[model samples]
Target chain A: MTYCVGLRMKRGLVFMSDTRTNAGVDNISTFRKMHTWCVPGERLVTLMTAGNLATTQAVISVLEERSKAQGERNPSILEQPSMFQVARLVGETLREVISERSTQGQAADSAFGATIIVGGQIDPGPPRLFLIYPEGNFIEASEDTPFFQIGETKYGRPMLLRGFSEDLTFPDAIKLLLVSFDSTLKANLSVGMPFDLQTYVADSFEIGHEDRITRDNPYYNEISEGWGRALREALGQLPPYDMG
Target chain B: MTYCVGLRMKRGLVFMSDTRTNAGVDNISTFRKMHTWCVPGERLVTLMTAGNLATTQAVISVLEERSKAQGERNPSILEQPSMFQVARLVGETLREVISERSTQGQAADSAFGATIIVGGQIDPGPPRLFLIYPEGNFIEASEDTPFFQIGETKYGRPMLLRGFSEDLTFPDAIKLLLVSFDSTLKANLSVGMPFDLQTYVADSFEIGHEDRITRDNPYYNEISEGWGRALREALGQLPPYDMG
Candidate 1:
């Protein structure tokens, strides 16, 4: 299981994902789920994946191999004219990988399927964010729905719904994402730490900032403990039930 | 859809359930999900249901009918000597109803299945809580697992995990439950007010307190708004992420 979130705001976009993957309770390993491709001064594309590790890895490898190769025969993420085209390329790649795996007798919608969140900016166009389904279809984020979450999303959704705003600063958005991820990590064993975070400022055409937060990181620890204490204090302050 | 929770604490037990049931977004109505049967000084049992409305209503109707009828052939919940026995009786009744419906060609494990949370006190035994599955098997809550939630559970679970304590007072427990339900209500359209809440005090062998909290209830509104403000304030106080 995995938990990844992509937020599109007036100022920029923020992406965060956990690194834990498990086949069962006894078989668990750490793997990065955030992949980024950048052509400085031209475009920056970020992809976060959830679901079958094999499918996600295959999709990423195919894109990376093509991007490094020299030819128009194989479309590369770096060559996409706009963020919309980048999303289309990623969705097509995901569908191809899943279809190939299905021919080997694996169910298409079973554990072999994967979902991806694509967000980036291309020169001469505005920044964009999309959630690509396993079937090669995708939907872009809008004002009413300015965020996308994949895998184990419910546990962390209330915070995002209540805290997200179009005008939030980059620091505030990252803080909100950390709180959201902390809640998920505590409630579910499947989502764990060493989180990968990246931010893109609107119209920058470059990756603004990035970091990997581990369990021992002071800021992450502060948010975890501080949020717990704050919740308890908040509960205490609420008016008690009338019980009459 | 429905949302119900049962918490077992050192002082007593707390049970809360939303009254909304819907076949789909357009077909929604309010129906109480919390049922109580009390023979004061002997036994007090509270049952909360989630899943197929038909299955749950049938199980409750059967239990109520048998308890009032003059029959020694069928064991009624009122005749159970221990809380554990009460849980077993409810689980068996749920399984019977599901099987009966299945003989009519309905799939037993489909949307027709129902899950129940049974909690209460019987004379000579401590208060207890059990989560009865659709398959006639049930598991009791213990120190490690002190609560059980059914239907749309993920949105509200983090609050329960962070606020619950074995020694919480009845008032504190109710407050915690209200916060949990408020989160679910805001995040889901399927789960809504008015909520039914009940508490049982150990050794009393009688219901302690009960209330039906509606949307216009002042205390409910206070908790809902207070929690949202507290969360935002908490997010602001957390150490900002060091985006390097």
Candidate 2:
């Protein structure tokens, strides 16, 4: 299971992904599911992926391999003309990855899904967010759905949906995400600790934050503590049940 | 679809369940999901159920029918000495309901899952919580897994896992549950408005606190507001991403 969220806020874009993966509960492992492509001030694109590991990595490898071609014109992340183009390229790349994996040799290997969040800014425009569906197509973020959550999203989504309002600062977005993630982590054994977090301020022409939070990360710990304490405090504040 | 949770805490037991039941997206109806048959001060018992309405109603019908019998000696709930026995009786009732439905001969449908939460204190012991499964079996709540959630539980399960501590006041428990349900309601279209909530103090020996929370419930509004405010505050406090 995976829990990755991309928030496209008035301030900028925030991306976070859990580092746990389990193939049946017994075979659990940590694998980074985020991919970053940076051309400094030119374009900063990041993708947080969820679903089949092999499929996701293969998609990333396709993009990476494209950037390394020696002779002909290669359409690479660095070469994409715009953020929209970058998303299109990603969809095309993922489509190819799944197609290549389809084979008669693989018996009973049927339905597949790989959802990805593409968010970033080119030096020219505001940071943007897109939800690339399993079908190799995507949708951009809008006022109605300002955020996209992939993998184990149901548990923590309400916080993002109802809590997210316009004019929300980058920081508020991050905090909402932590509680959402905190909620998800506690409920799901599949989504474990040590999260990969990245936040980019819109039009800053660079990523403002990037960190991997383990159980010991101070800020992460603080938010978790404050949330629990606040919850208790909130509970105390509620009018007592008139069961007496 | 419904959301029901049973928690066993030092202060006693808390049970809450949403009443909305829908067979599909279009046909939504409200049927009470909670039922209580208490001997009052001498014995207090509450039964909260979720899944397959027919099956659940059937189980309740059987139990109620037996309780009303003038002289029956077959391990009825009224005759049970311990809350554990009552749990078994509920589990057995569920098994019987499913079995009767299956024996009607339609290729043995696997469409039967009616789990019940039975919590109460008999004449003399600590109040306990039990989750009755479909197979005429049950599991009691313990310290490590202090709560049992049945039916549409995954979404809200995370919030409780993170926020639940034995020290949390019953109000806090209720607050946490409302937020959890809020998350579930937003993410899943099947679960909806107007929630049924009930909270019990350990040895009070009666259904003391109960409320029907509709769209206009004041406390419900406060919880949703406070939750959003806290998330935004938490986000503001996170260190800005420094992705170079």
Instruction: List iRMS for all predictions.
Output: 1.3, 3.7
lDDT of each: 0.89, 0.79
Best by TM-score: 1
Question: Which stretches of candidate 1 lie above 4 Å from their native place?
Answer: A66-75, A103-109, B66-75, B103-109
lDDT (Cα, tens digit) per residue for candidate 2, span A82-122 = 88988898888777777667653574454456888999988
Candidate 1 TM-score, C-alpha based: 0.94
lDDT of 1 at B131: 98
Per-residue lDDT over A1-244 for candidate 1, one digit per residue giving the tens place of the 0 to 100 score: 8999999999989999999999877899999999998888889899999999999999998988754646543438888899999999999999999888988764545557899999989998888999999999999999999999999998899889888898998888998998889989988899988999999998888888889899999888888898889888877777776666
**Model 1, C-alpha of A243: deviation from truth (Å):** 2.1
* lDDT minimum window of 10 residues, candidate 1 chain A: A66-75
lDDT of 1 at B129: 94
